[model samples]
Target: MDIHFYKISISGIVQGVGFRPFVYNLAYKHNCIGEVYNDADGVLIKLGCKDIEVFLDELQALAPPLAKITKITQETIEPFERSDFVIRQSHDANSSTTILSPDIAMCDACKKELFDPTSKRYKYPFINCTHCGVRYSIIKNLPYDRINTAMGVFMMCDACKKEYEDPTSRMFHAQPIGCNDCGVKTFLHVNTTTIQKDTLYHTAELLKEGKLGAIKAVGGFHLVCDATDENTVQKLRQNKHRPTKPLAILVKDFAMAKKYGVFSEKEKEVLLSKEAPIVLVKKNRSDLASAIAPGIDKVGIMVASNPLHLLLFEYIDTPLVATSANLSGEPIITTKEDIEQKLPFVDFILDYNREIINAIDDSVVQVVDEKLCILRLARGYAPLHLKLPKKIDEKVLALGANQKASVAIAFEDNLILSPYIADLDTIESIEHFQSMIANFKRFYNFDFDVVLHDSHPAYESTKIAQTFDTKKVAITHHKAHLLSVMTEPSECVSFVFDGTGLGEDGELWGGEVFVAKERKYHFKPLVLLGGEKAIKECYRVALSKLFEVYPLDEVMELELDVVKRYKSKIPLLYHLFQSKKNLKTSSVGRLFDMVASIVGVLHEQTYEGEAGLRTEALVGTLTREKRFEFTIQEGVIDIAFDFFASDFVERFYATLCSIVITLAKQEEKKVLFSGGVWQNKTLLEFVISELQKENIPYTFNTIVPINDSGISVGQIMEYING
Candidate 1:
């Protein structure tokens, strides 16, 4: 029989997902002799086979569960004499094209081995296989070899080495594979004492006893305490200085999660997915500490995604508040020393020997209108990879907005977005942003040809663009927000609503409607008294809007609590309002704040989006057919406020939906929604329902975040389209 030799190259998430072993086994089944190895580009296979088409078809169809093969190419190659198939060493190239796999949840196979008494890795906290465990978090360079990871410091044991070298073994070529004898070790630090034995048990005990502990996991550290303990939860909030901000909880499994939150089928699937993000679901029971979510009716719940968390659950059945260990508006803590120095209130610390080279927080997602909406993209959901329609010659870097910062790099046909970096208001967050940029550059061997940033002149990201020794492009904030949801270059109508962004006219714009690239409509601008301070102290925004319709005496005579609470400060604010020296904004996000304040849901926000969240929570199952009166004339939409309405918040949501539907009807174009305001689940669902009822086509971000975390992707898209 005649033999054919073919060179096959496959790209995308193929490096650390057991692609080589799957290929090697598949080759044998197909009666082919081949050698498979990873290269800078992806997995490369040299196959000597009788039927090439059959082999290639099965190669794609029977790929490993975790492998995501984006592109595959085959070509005729010279045949080499070989007795049998083999797995070859990885090849390093100056430039890398391989996508790094995100850190995955602990697989069932690993979990089984972890608990089975007969298994060698029984009770091992760091048990992992080719199917799961650390990936992007531990990796330092490309080709994804064991030597290029944080695990390279530990030498494998004899048994582990044997398993890693065996072609048929599940752990064959698993870069992070190790047995207990040669794996990373856990340490528990309490006061001046260090305890190495039974650390998980000790940590669990502390949590059960209502003591706060910082425990390191696959990505970073989490400040953990018993979720069912009200005082403990309150203590954690006090220590973190996170009053009223909902804390995410880690449960043992779906059953436990179901007890605390009502999970739909889609939410359940996302909770059990390999990415294993924190899913926001409606609260189902009151057994959890009231302080865990505060005023919100929904809870952020996640299943144990790592062996350490799973094993800790074995010691304690109570759910734990597993919030990221970090200061407000800063990056998640990675090192034990940093955790010790920063989180001094923690009673104990659980740490491991392996280094976390790339620290990321848990990704958060929600099911809106029965579709997945990413709120925060990190950990398993990043570095996000998107394919370009065509390869570009210029390598571009996009620095996202100042808040919810993320960076993206576009090289050739690949666009990689970094994990979410928190708000860049702090020095720590800015450094983290710089580190993310450096990591992406090193991963792709990238020297950017151009840098893109938001048009806001004072934005840290925009200022960072000035230091870059390349061509810099400024994309208007709302335009970038619209572009993030555009899959193709086509004329469409988009609603870009958020808290604050610099507009082309130098005013603060957060509520905007765009027909194609033209700003065709906007919400009537309102004065933001006290400027930036009004965002945190939202009562100022409410008072300013009230001032628009009512004179000073009429406003003061109103029975609104906000008016009463800030009675003394009103004179100075009214003076500022009269002078018109404050910033003017057309922000729907601020509108939510205004409504929330007027209705007494929230007056001041301790965290971003607090007022909006509280307002949504207060609406509960109430629905009102009544909408506040709104008029659109000459490309502007103006609302008449009836702040005294019994169901004002519900009516406010209804009116916003009415506005969007009216605009869609007028333009007769597909409606697209973007920006942080779209993260409001209640508002998004209401608008989606209205659009469907009217038989209007509408879409919002489902892959990337609808929030500002997606700004980097939009910036890159804007650059490409422009």
Candidate 2:
């Protein structure tokens, strides 16, 4: 009687996820007896007798990559006599309710059973059995046992019970298993009133009919709507108070997707990948609806991540604009009660209380070539921390901006980018951030004595950091933008660009240029005479500058007269311009804004990025016979030297006035448009034409992200060297 022992430790997202059952099947396959249980660290296992080395080797090799093996301690020991393998109760001693991974949509295996007519879970919207489905949502505490989850309600039926007990079944010990007969189910409930529609077609009908509705999705509530129908789309947008910003479109399949936007092979592959994100694709050439993206040319599209989403498109067979259910800047709605209260503003509520343990908005991405570039990383790829390239001296916690919020941490020189959660002001997001910091601390047991935050001193993330006694470092706005360039191996003068950041002299900074390295950066900001104050003063400086320049013709001479005509509407703009001290910035974002405002494209912004959005769109109309000349003067400092040749303000006022005078909807061409604003096709094409003769090496956001979201990587780089 040879007593042999095998010790196993599981890692990654294995603890709360169903790794134990997977282990059981493997043990059964190898004809070995083992006992598996959960621990604070991860999964602990003991296998007994016969050929243990080969079995352990195989199990470790086959372990899922998602299951990160941070550290595995294995030892040979005497095996305890056991007839079969069993998943024992969790060890209660160190059950830290650590933050778990964000919920993922159902996998194909589960989707098959869900939609198959012959299966017990046929048509089950919430038919997940641990291989893939909502996990973090249902969990109330760590250890992830059924009693600790939202699934504690609905008792299991006979079939589900047997499946849960069967080690061979996929649902073996799955905490969130079952269907309408024995598990969670959906009902068409609006304003707390339950409806009788059991099928998705009927539900879609109510949605198409403009009935206010709420959909309880994997992570939270989605206020879904008909996108193709202009009236329906308008109604939802109006009700949500979201007027200008483009709403994301959720399509059925890749084929229907072609109807709205164009995708290259690179874009298509990224779209179909497991981490399904709402990808921003360019519109080919069509009259789908001006209202879809309003002033922009790009559309955010996502496929069905779950069975319910698949069924949704089949019923309507139409494109749907699926946005998070919440007021502007609020967290996504996650509960049925949230729907009941918010449904009056909507038409109906589609939800099931399967328990949402975590909150995540739709993740959005884009592909330039073969590599996928993340625009907004959430859902399928969040809370999954990335390892840093080198070790650092101190642990620094980074509190990112208020919107598209993500908190970062540096431990042992590895940087972990947290997932985006809405509203830093809310207790939920703040609490989530704080708890996540602690969760990482406990797992790695790192030295967390230092803190780093955005220089926006007023951010909620910074206010929270005040409670900690850690040494803190403040990263400047543009410097961080420059740093994003350092993360990649390529070295270039970072044309750090975006919409907003506090300038060094305490004014808004956007567009910028920086020659960067890991340690330091030389930056130049694109600013007005008094920074934003000048712009607010109706660009009095712009008018003054334009008047002083020798006029090429009377078309340019109209500048001062133009300033006087708008006095009634722009009294403040003139004041801010004259009163402020020397304004300076190396901001490219503001450069675009100034151009847009000068162009009179979006004088009064309705949203956060009105100027940028409009400018990019306006560029498309131009036939570029020539390109503008931009040069670096006095070292790396960039100046609009050629722009000095023209009284741009006069030209701007003249052109805009002419357009109104002529009752024309569009305008003429100018400069090479790139950066995020290029996302607007109108501006993209316009810039190409006006500067056509220059024929500069024109490029838009291809492999690189054109939006402000890319600034995080820039932040990481600047901080490392700065």
Candidate 3:
């Protein structure tokens, strides 16, 4: 009896990831005689087995682990007299364009060739085949062939063509295959001329000569320099207009990272993961320069991934502050024209002519208990959407904000959390977000049914949602925060704190206490603002409160100048707290801001969380750990602020000092230190000292982040149950 054969098409992140090879092996093992090919939509599989049931079971059940089989469709046809299974050249189904995958990190074989001087790709910055090299940034269309990519101009030579045609070879069907004969070249621009075309070695010399240059990294443009040189770093900071925000330092490898930051097993793994993300690591007292990460005790660091970075390290002995080549709070520009126009301050530009289809900023992460703490997921990690734990029936798309942004895609019940971070805080960022989402929809052939947006109504993200012609669900900013956390239902006293998030009441909210069970929550906003000026001025607010109680004018009968005369920092507080533009805020972050400002720890903040960070650093050094007394009466936990104001700041000049003294004399108390404010080292030191004197035990976040990033995960859990 004659049997019919079946042809199948599968799509969604199926290519480059060993999918075709896996299917070839599967078809061969199953005794099927049909061919598999790559098309616009995923992989195409064919089956012509005599025993249909066995062939179907084996093919369907034993798919590759990484292959995300989104949809599968098959058509039955007359069987061909084929003897063996093979990977035929890809056939064009004339399908829609596909999303470009990221450049995977160098595999073991590539890493081996990198050090071998005899290898063709030795010290080659753009060494890649299918396994690694630029993907999403280089591709403009689907079926992911070289003709559809930026590398199309560089044709394959005899050696590469041989490997590519040989089915038994690793490079078989590898689209990005390139050789020295036809590969990307680098040129150094000294002034207006593109000089130093011969080698990457001379580029290092120019950098050493105090020349500010732009380096074309594998995924994007990077501003490189010797981190040990104080002047070089300071100059970049001034030029980049990023003086206060700490720059991430890139080391040669994991071994070199040991010199500056403390890394556990989890941190090391994340540093070397395929994504090759930058992780925040705690600095040892004697490690690298204090100025590297200025206000905070922790520094962001990453090991070099691109081969060019490795080559640069060979010429220079010290680590480089390998930050993105762009202005502060701006998107990293990739095109040459943009480089010249935007980075006029740069001394030279090392550039190549290639089109970047998509822009992915660097991924930034932190380590917790040797595991990755994702702060910003970009580059090697973007477009890799996070799978939702729960399935929802509504077709929903969330337009997250530009800062700490994330878009949630819901289909039926399955949702996708598209990896993203805060945009560069500009009108262009909002436009980019809208454009990317439109692209995401086109790429997946899916449209938003009911859209969910943050309640920050004035935000660009919210505005984008309104533009969409779909049902809208405006999730409160804080609710999104709570829902993002606790993906599962659980009863817990949750403390959500951060820089700022829009709350249900149309005010910037961050510090919050909640009794949560699934999506059901009763939230109480902490740190009330006295008026418009108290927005971020935490210290000024406290001073205002103290004045109300102490009656400053009566305390010392003198001119209004007398209150301003002590130069006690109270005058500035008055001006700040009473200022019209200061704005009102009931956030815990602002509360810490006030404390840090008042305690003489920080007068002005250069970055969003700098004041809190400096204060925490100081606390870590010498903490008396004085546990403040409070009472939980009638559903409300009330603490007396009278001591902090009337007695503490008025009659006594040093309340923090007194708190330290009190804690130092105690013993055996269990001290709990948390909130984003605890990220301050100095406050932690004080808390630690007091706890130690009293023999108090303490635990900092290991399973959970001590920052607002984790607050959303908690929020997720709280809402998931509902």
Candidate 4:
């Protein structure tokens, strides 16, 4: 048989994920002689084969489990003599489209070897193999090799070296391959004492005593304590300065998780998957300390996604409150110095010597309408790659909204989103955002043709995009949200609701309904008093709406108890609304804030979406469905609030659903829900149920976050289409 010479290139999350080892084994099995190597672009394979079709089919069918092949290319090459298949060293040839894989949870095979006494990696804190281990978090650069990773410092031992060299061994060419003799070491610090011996065991003992410990995991440090200990949980909250925000806990397994939180079969599958994200589940038992989640009925829970955490369960039987080890509103702690400096209140610190190049936080998800929706995308779930429905000619960079920020890069028909970045208000978070953008540019090695940003000129991200030496496109914030989840180039009636975004008409838009066919708007503009300061004070928003339809004296005469309670602020708010001095906003989020303040649930916004979240939580208790009087005349919704009672919350949601369905019927188009407001479970459920009852087709974001974190994706989509 005559041999054929071929060169193949495979792209996507193929590096640092056993792709080379997989290619080496496949070549030997298929009786082909060639060399496989890694380069700046992706995997490069040169092969000499008699029947190339069979070889290519098998390789595609049996790629490594961790490898995600986004694109594959093959071409005829000049013949070269080679005796046998071999793995070659990685090279930095040129700008590459190859992207690093997100850090994956430890596979069961590695977990088994870690626990077996006969295995060389038994009881090893940093035990990892070819199939699973750290990837993006530890990687410093591309052509992902040991030298480009934090693990480069830990040279392999003789036993590991042998396995890494053997073609038949699972760890052949595994960059992170290591054994107990030559792996990262752990240390335990308790108060002023530092102990190198029995660190894991002693840390477990401390947790059992209701003491909090900062434990280093794959991404960053996590503050851990016994979840059953009320005082210990409370102490963690007080020290972290996180007063009422719910804490995430880590259980040993799915069965234990089910015992505390209700889980569906799909949810159980997600929890057991390699991603192992913190899943928000409804609480089934109240026996565990209520301080873990406080008044919230839903609790965020996760399982051990790494070896050290699984081993910790051996000494400690109960669940642990595993929250990010940083002060509230700060980035996650990665360096030991940060843990010591920022979180000195912890009883002990359990850490390893391995460096974390990218400090990622745990991803958080919730099941909405029986489908998983990402709340915060990071760790195993970020650097999200998606193939667009249509191809683009030039490369583009999209900067997301200011809050819950994320950056996206678009080239050809693909869009890759960076891991979720914090709000851009702080200096640290802004630096992190810029660093992520720089990293994406370096990794993809592309000259961006254009940069896309929110139309809000005041946004920091918008300002940053303007500084880039490329053509810039300003997309309306709500329009970007509508396009974020549009998988196809189709028109539909969309509802976009969030805290605030600059509208095309130069108004602050929070809640909006538009027909994509003509971009017609059907929204009631609610004037906001006090400009930017109005966001923090909900009473101003409530009084602003009251002043819109009533005389100043009549507004003062309203019988609402909350208005009476904060009677002093009404005079100033009324004057601001009358003069139109406080910026005019048509924001639905402010309406929620107004209602939240009116009911006396949340008066001031200490954090983003606080009023909306607290108001939605009340929906769980009130089963009564009532419709508040809302009138729609000449494309505006007018609600005359007669009372500020508990029933009004349910009424507002019900009325909103009715109006959306009515508009969808009139337009004769499917409905699309996008924005942060849909993140509210109560409002989402009501809207979904109403749509289903009317048999109206609707679509929501499943691949990306419904909030502004996904705005970058929409920005790219609109730019490409334009």
Candidate 5:
């Protein structure tokens, strides 16, 4: 038999996900003698076998569950004779092109092993295998090995070492494979006592008794309490300063999840996906605590993403509110010191030894139009990489929008986005954002040729962009939003809406409908009062909208609940509105706030999109056929129609859909929608329905997020396209 020798290289998401071990086993199975190793670029394999074609085919076809091979190149090479297949040590080079895998949910094999009574890992909280375990969060650098992670501190016991070394074992070359005897250990704290015995059981018991505490997970800490207990959930809200905003709940499984929220098949698929993101579904059980997600008709639910979470569920019957362990507008807590010092309200702490290098929050997603739409990209869905339509030769850094912030670095043809950074409002959040950028740059050895940021001069992210020692370019906020979803440049009528972004005209723009290819068009500019303060107070926005057409006396006399509720602030707001003391905004977000207030559903905005989400939620059983008339005067779209809040909300959405459809039909083009407002499921449904009715070929955000978290990608895209 004639033997052939070959060297192969594979790129993309090959490190830290058991790619080397997979290749080692596959080569051995094919009766080939070879060694596989991870390098700075990707996975490298050398094989000497008689039939190389079959080996290569099975290598790609029978790859591990977590392996994602993007590119593979092979060539004939002089291979030395080898006695056996081996997994070589990783090679550390000067440059990095390898993609990092996001954190994965615990696999079914690990789950079964964890619960098996006779198994050594019985009821082990940290049970994991090669196919499933923490990856991105624990990893500090590339060439993903145990030494580069927090798990480096724990030395594998003899039993674990044997399993890890044996080629026939499933745990072979599993970087995170460890049992309770040698892996990460969990410790529980109750009141003033810290106990290592039965930590998971104690934590579960405390949760069952309606206690609120911080529990360390794969990514970071989560403040948890019984979701079914109203008092406990209310206490959590009061302590966390998270009022009215919906909190994500962690259920036992799909069966328990069904009790709280109704899920579609697609939504179910996402819920059960390896990512295990928080899937937003329609609210069903009214018995859940109202404080969990007050005023909203939808709830975010997540099944167990880790063995620890599943272990806690064994002793508890009800769902748990597993919200991020951080103060409002701050980053999620990753360390024990941060949790103890920052969160004094937590009653107890369920801590773990394994360190989380990259502190990421849970990813939030919803199935929109049967597609999994990412809202807040993190955890299982982040450190995302995408190939641009055209190669970008310049090494560029993009500081995303201040709200829902994320950073992006473009090199070659790849755009790498960091996990979701919380809104850069407070000093802590800004520092966190800066740290993320610094870490990313250092990790990839990136030096910027140019920096891209929002056009808004006062934005924290833009301010950071200015401090960078590189050529700076500012992209209009709406333009970035519109371009973020576009793969290639095309003529399309785009509808971009959000709370506020600096327009090219130096005014705050949000409600914009324009020809994106031309980069010019009309907007519904509203009278904004009190500048930045108007964002928190929905009444001010409502008063401004009312005073736009009606006189002060007439507006005061109007039977609006918001006007009556904040009568004292009305006079001052009116004075400011007349004096033009506020920033002019063409913001659809403010319109939602105004309508939410005017309809008496909400009075203030405690969180981002609170008013808009509430308004969308209130459109409950209302028919979609009802739409109010809108006047497009000169070039601007005027929504100065008189209607109650509920009717106004529905009408506003229908009118926007109609406008986009009409504009698309007139221009003979497809419609593209982007922005934070696009996260509103109701409005998106309406627009999609309208477009489908007219058979319009409309494009929307599916790959990346529609919110400001996606702004970084758009900024980079803008630079590349230009």
Candidate 6:
């Protein structure tokens, strides 16, 4: 019989996801004789088979669930003598091109074993197999193996070692394979006392008593408490200094999740996915404390994704308020010491001995217009890798905008993005950003040829870019937002609207329409009377808008709460508006703030997107829709409208939709939507419905975020197009 020898190279997320064992079994099934192993680039196979094409077809068709095969190539080679198909040790090279798998949720098999009394791993907090376990967060270096991960320090017991070596066992070659006999131990710390025995039981008891505890999770730490306890939830808010921002809840399973929130089919699928991100859904139960989301009708919900979390749920019945353990605008805390020192309100600490090399927060997503929209990309959805349309000659790094900071690195047709780093507003957040950059460099053994940053000169990311010892290029912020959603270099009309970004003309431009790469139109500029203070106190923007069309006495005569409350400061605010010395902005996000204040939804914002969220909530409460007049002339759009109408919020949204439709009609091209403002579901749905009715094509971000967290990816896209 004739034999064929072929060398196969496969790349993409093929490591630490049970790819090697799958390949080993596939080789035997195909009657092939050779070996499979991992290398720097990806999986490599040397096969001697009768029909290589048939084997290749089955390989792609029956690959593991978590494996993502991007590229596969085969080359004929000299036939070699091989007795049997086997798995070999990983081969490390100078540099790596393989994509790292994001951390995956616990598999059904592991969960089953965790609850089985007969199983050795029953009630074990760190049980994992090759099918599902920690990946990115525990990994320290490439060519993924036990020695290169946080699990290397733990020696496997006799039973675990036997299972690790057995090809038929699910734990075969699992990097994080461990059992209670020889793995990390959990401990509960309460008021200078350490409780080592029955820690999970004690932790659950404390949480049931409405005690706030910091629990170590797969990526970082979570400040956990009973979600139904209003007093505990309020205490968490005061202690964390996160006043009115919504907190996410962790449920035991889909049944428990359904009790608190109404999930669509698509939302349910994403919630149960391996990524296991927090999904925003309609609040269904009033039993949950009102303080959980206060004023917002939607609640963020996620299922327990890891073994430790699942085990905790076995003892606790109530949903747990699982907010990241960190200061406001800071990275998630990863160390036990840090959690104990920083979060003084934590009544106890549920911790383990395992080290967390990378600290990632939980990713957030929501279903918009029957499609998935990413809000915060981290944990199970990061260390994201995208294949470039074409290879680039130089290695590049993109430092994203300041608010929702993230970094991206592009090299050799591969673009890798870091997990969502918190806003670079504090010293700790800046340090976290720098550490993530350093981690990426070390992971890929990378040296950048150039770095890209926002045009905003004073942005912390821009300042850090100047410190980098490499060539730097500044791209306008709005343009970067536009390019992030564009798949190819084509002429299209893009509407980039957000709260703030530096324009090419050195003004704060957020409400902008661009044809191709050139800005074609913008909203009429509105003066921010107190600069940054206007953002925190949204009523100032409302007053400024009112002063734009009305005289001081006329504005004062209007019976508005803003005017009644700030009656004394109105004259000075009007003077600042007339002087125009304050920063000028064309921001639709500020428009939301203005409308929200006028409707008495909120006069001040405690969170980043509070005004927008409250305004969006009002869209559902409107009894009727009315027309609000607007004008487009001289490359500017005027949004001055009557603020006294009962349905002003509804009319304002309708007018914005009309503006987009009008622009699309004029441009006669596909429309691309981006920026943080698109996260407002009501407005985006309105525009989408109108565009579809008019038979106008439109596109938006699905893979990455539409917010500033995706700015780094957009910056790279801009550079590539240029």
Q: What is the TM-score of each candidate against the true structure?
A: 0.98, 0.80, 0.81, 0.95, 0.97, 0.98
Model 1 C-alpha lDDT per residue in residues 229-294, reported as the tens digit of each score: 999888888888898899999999998999999988999999999999999999999999999998
lDDT of 2 by residue, 1-722 (tens): 45477787654467645678878888888777878987655688888757767776776788643454554667877647788878888765433322354566677788778778889888877777766766655666666678878888879999899999987787888788887688776777655577655657767887677554667777788878777677777877787777877888888889888788899887887777666778888876554546778876688888887778887766787777788888666678788776666546776777765767667777877664344656566777766445556666766667665545666665554455665665565675667666656655654445557676677778776677677787776676666655543344233333344556665657666544433232122124433654544443434434434323333243243444434455453444434434644565544445555565555444445565566566554543232222333333443333332333234433332232222211111112111112343343343343333334343332334322344443444455556655
Q: For each candidate, what is the lDDT?
A: 0.90, 0.60, 0.60, 0.84, 0.85, 0.90
In model 2, the number of clashes is 61
Tens digit per residue, CA lDDT, model 6, 434-516: 99889878877868899999999999999999998989999899999998884553668899999999999999999999988
Off by over 4 Å in 6: 489-491, 621-625
Residue-pair clashes per candidate? 0, 61, 63, 1, 0, 0
- Candidate 3 vs. truth: CA RMSD? 6.5
* Residue-wise C-alpha lDDT for candidate 5, range 498-519, written one tens digit per residue: 8899888888888887675454
Output the TM-score of candidate 6.
0.98
Could you tell which candidate, 3 or 6, scores higher by lDDT? Answer: 6
State the weakest 10-residue window (summed lDDT) of model 1.
618-627
TM-score of 3: 0.81
Distance from true location, Cα of 667 in model 4, Å: 1.1
Indicate the residue-level lDDT of 186 in model 5. Answer: 85
lDDT, model 4, position 460: 91
Give model 6's clash tally.
Answer: 0
